[model samples]
Target: MSSNAEIKISGFPEDDGYWFVKWIDEFRLPHLTTSSASVKVVLQKLGSVDFHNLNNLGSTDIRSILGQRKKDADVIIEIRCPVVMPGTLPLVFIGAIYQRGVYVGRLPTRRRTIALADGGQEGFELSLSQQITPPPGWPEGAPYSLLNRFEYSVIPNIMRSSRCLMINRGEDTFIIPRMTIFKTFYAPHTELAKAFCGGPWNDRLDEVICLDDFESGLKTQKITHPEQWNIILQVRVPDVFAPLLACFTLMSSQDRALL
Candidate 1:
């Protein structure tokens, strides 16, 4: 989960330009308030262009003119920004440039999105190879034996991996994701009722960082936000049938016919 990669800047001529952008905030919007985030901004600047010329690039519409200044020979502008990647919330920008404040070419800030520990690429790193412990009564390899086959995988947010399909023998086995989501600045356990515990807000995020270090025999952890919050463990097991016993039943004929 390398969020702060090279402090990048696009749109401006990569060859030459004096773009001075600094992240002074050690723990905030610009500096990442939590350990899970790393802030980086892409400063867009075209040489000597008026505000009207500095369009969003995607839109053909022009901006209204005011007192524009080219005071600095090099355009000594400072944009303290960060690349925000909230946990579980997939990265989506319906519009370009951050539209929070007066987006006078405020520039779109691309956030680094970290998946929920189980439902994301970073989810399996910690949970995989860790070995799934069977129920207290089952033997070490009993779960594997009971089932025809078992496996796990990581599913990216872009992919729609859910509990929709049924797993047929030797078929329909999608990626099994296990996520550990860190919930920082989270409300106290008492305040959250049981119904709210497993809900989306249970891990209502502060920040999220993806790490490939987990399950790789290494301890590189992906962090996402500003606070030292704990993770709510959620397991997305492979779509497999759970073994169960049923005695003499009237639906036997129907079950056989369906099968």
Candidate 2:
């Protein structure tokens, strides 16, 4: 994280509430070394609201935040990100919604990846419409009230490659497998579980199935306390993704809500 590399957000709703948001990022030197790279920026919702009155609350909040008393909106999520790498690869903005530690639905952004270079700075904008449809696999006719939190990750496709398995059984003879073995890149839930149920708890859990069992325990009445089952979302950029320089400076903004 170079001092020159920073992320900032402005135009947040305050005096005149507006749902629109502008995010700016400045990446220099080490952050822009690679010709192309895949980096994910995650946006996690922290507040917990009552689901029973979700409709009224959502409408009221929208009107209040957007400074439009007459206009009504179901939901609004507009944000921008710096596009360090731009090509044919589309920007994948996915939202994973959860309710009490249970995976419920996913929301995919509507906008495509666009290159906007201003004085050596590059970025793109993401806008979700008011008539957003429920993600596939969501229960038909189910209300959005079931959702408690949102974890959205913006993944820009830059390093695209294909892998092939070549097996040699005889001299000068090789066989290529037609099928490609797919592996899960990353599991956010499992990572959360690991962080929450670490140390002595791991020993007590069964070996055959751990993550499923942990989720089941949380879903069932095994965890009596509601606070115990809370899922905390953390956004971390591993060293593999953003290699840091020894003396580079890093800038970050603290969330006032957390304070």
Candidate 3:
């Protein structure tokens, strides 16, 4: 039997701009205050105008305006989640830039912050140039007998990878084998949870299973009739990784559902 928890982010602004988002989750485990998280920002070219034309904003900080961009290219920004005091709440800062007297929507920042608790750790590196690979030190000859044929049929091949998210806390390494959207009843108490915790799924019982809404995103548009699917994650790690896992899950689902 494993523990279950929910991490939610609210009060995000309704305005459209470059978003500086942070999420914090406090755990009851010893020597652990919060989980390390990361943010992935993808800037796609919408029109003929290049991203370089929107420069000359200000200094490079989270509060600063978005910087320049290369012509005919998409920009991807990755920020390591900051560490705050145990009692501090999470925040999402919206930054807008001014170009030619007109306000630009959003931008990126390069400023870094010091962590109060355990300092800030480097974010998990997710490369867009390579495919999703399995975590290191995985058992070579183990069988993936966890998900049944019917379950495998529903999930895409890319989602079945051995690594979804990885978190490093000192000497302890946490790996999220995989995350997917399924019926609400298929997680926690079902065989899915057991399969994720046992056998080839990492063989660790100290796990954190999180069930969250599938429609969670940073966009302003509200879903007219949202689906009832829930994002299920069987993270073979301590409870501190719950919030970070949830954060990556939402981002990956919204940004790269096909990959």
- Tens-digit lDDT string for candidate 2 (1-259): 2111122222112222211211112222323555333222223332234223334455444334323222323444333333422110111122332332223333322333333335423222122211124556868885321111231111111111212233323242221111111111211123322322232323522211223325444421123455322221124333331111111111122422121
- Per-residue alpha-carbon lDDT of candidate 1 for residues 1-259, written as tens digits (9 for 90 to 100): 1122233332222443323221111112322354343323333332334333444533212111111224323433333233433321122111222222212232223344323333332312321222343445666565331111121111111112221211222322222221112121121121221112323432521112112345545432223565222232222211121111111111255563442
Candidate 3: give its CA RMSD in angstroms.
Answer: 20.8
lDDT of each: 0.26, 0.26, 0.30
Which window of ten consecutive residues has the lowest lDDT sum in model 1?
Answer: 241-250
- The residue pairs found clashing in candidate 3 are 18-106, 66-107, 66-108
lDDT of 3 at 153: 20
- Candidate 3 local lDDT, 1-259, one digit each (tens): 2321232222222233323322122222222343322221112222213234335434432221123224313434332322222111211122322222123444544543323233423345331122333346746764333222222221122223222334555564443222211112123332333333233433422243343334655321223367332334454444444443343344445454332
Q: What's the number of clashes in each of the models?
A: 23, 2, 3
The reply for model 3, stretches above 4 Å from the true place, is 1-9, 17-205, 208-259
Query: What TM-score, computed on C-alpha atoms, does each candidate reach?
Result: 0.19, 0.19, 0.17
Clashing pairs in 2: 3-249, 83-123
